[model samples]
Target: MSDIKVISTENAPAAIGPYVQGKIVNGLLFASGQIPLVPATGAMVEGGIAEQARQALSNVKALVEAAGSDLSKVIKTTCFLKDINDFAAFNAVYAEFFNAPAPARSCVGGIDLPKGALCEIEVIAAV
Candidate 1:
């Protein structure tokens, strides 16, 4: 295998640690877990899971677009939440983006998240 190409975009939150926003390998785009952190100010979005999920997905949207793909091209997504009880609220927001024939997905509850954010998302998409 060749080196993994790092993917990044101003439209998405900048990598806060030692990770790239996403990577391309073997014609697939693998995105890092995107929290609701706003790239422009490096701050978490206001509100709870719904707003947080929205920002994170919107950020994912930007990353996919930057990689010459879009949400329709997404094949799978993994979601993380600080509280499982917020699942319903999160789904409400997520549904607006995925629409019908949604991509394969899985969500898990966690103890904590970066910047005290409520949710995070990562995606794999065709390229």
Candidate 2:
């Protein structure tokens, strides 16, 4: 495991479970799922899917940066939504983070997310 490293940051929510925020292995960062919880207070954010998506992606960005990567270095992402109808709104918010030639993504709706959040996101980035 000499090539493995754990990634953590105060800018992102602390993990309350057995998992860490992210892990780097052989030049790749694999971040854990991030909900809309505000890292400073550990409280879920307000508003609809858009707000939640932004917060969640913010958490993801923090972890990615902590691992010596950026959103632009992301290779893939997986998003979960509580309602499929919110996909459009979430996509709009997602675009604000990932630019042209955005990282490949796999977003699924109608899934239960942590903290009663409307959305959650996890990422795989180059570190």
Candidate 3:
């Protein structure tokens, strides 16, 4: 087995605390949860759910690229949202990025998110 490689990128949000942005092992890249916080300032993007979802997914894309994989290679994903009602909006934006043979996904709604953000995303991709 190949040694695990931690992935990071300045284009994506820096992990708020003690954690790598993503890690690769055995031909798979596992990305940590991506919040809507902009990497340049480490602050949440100023917008609604759709915007937040866009930013979060963009961040996840960056991590995937940093891990030597691209969004098209993503096999699975987990999404967290502050409100279930916004699922359609989120899915709309999500569909723009991942279409056709969509990656397996699990999207859940919750009462809160870090920094009061509206969405967060994580992904797993085969390299």
Measured against the true structure, the TM-scores of the candidates, in listed sequence, are 0.95, 0.97, 0.96
Question: CA lDDT of 113 in candidate 1?
Answer: 86
Write model 2 residue lDDT over 1-127, tens digit each, in one string.
5588999999999997999999998899999999999999999998988888899999999999998888999999998889999999999999999999999989888877777889989999998
1 or 3, greater by lDDT: 1
Candidate 2: worst-modelled 10 consecutive residues by lDDT: 107-116
Per-residue lDDT of model 1, residues 9-32, tens digit only: 999999999989999887789999
Task: Give the winner by TM-score.
Answer: 2
| Deviation in Å, model 2, residue 34 alpha carbon | 0.6
C-alpha lDDT score of every prediction, in listed order: 0.91, 0.92, 0.90
**Per-residue lDDT tens digits of candidate 3, residues 11-109?**
998888899998899999999999999899998888898889899999988898888878999999999989999999999999978977999999999
Q: Candidate 2 at residue 113, lDDT?
A: 76
- Cα deviation at 5, candidate 2, in Å, is 0.2
Off by over 4 Å in 3: none
For model 3 the local lDDT of residue 78 reads 93
**Residue 75 displacement (Å), model 1:** 0.8
Instruction: Judge candidate 3 at residue 43 and give its lDDT.
Output: 86
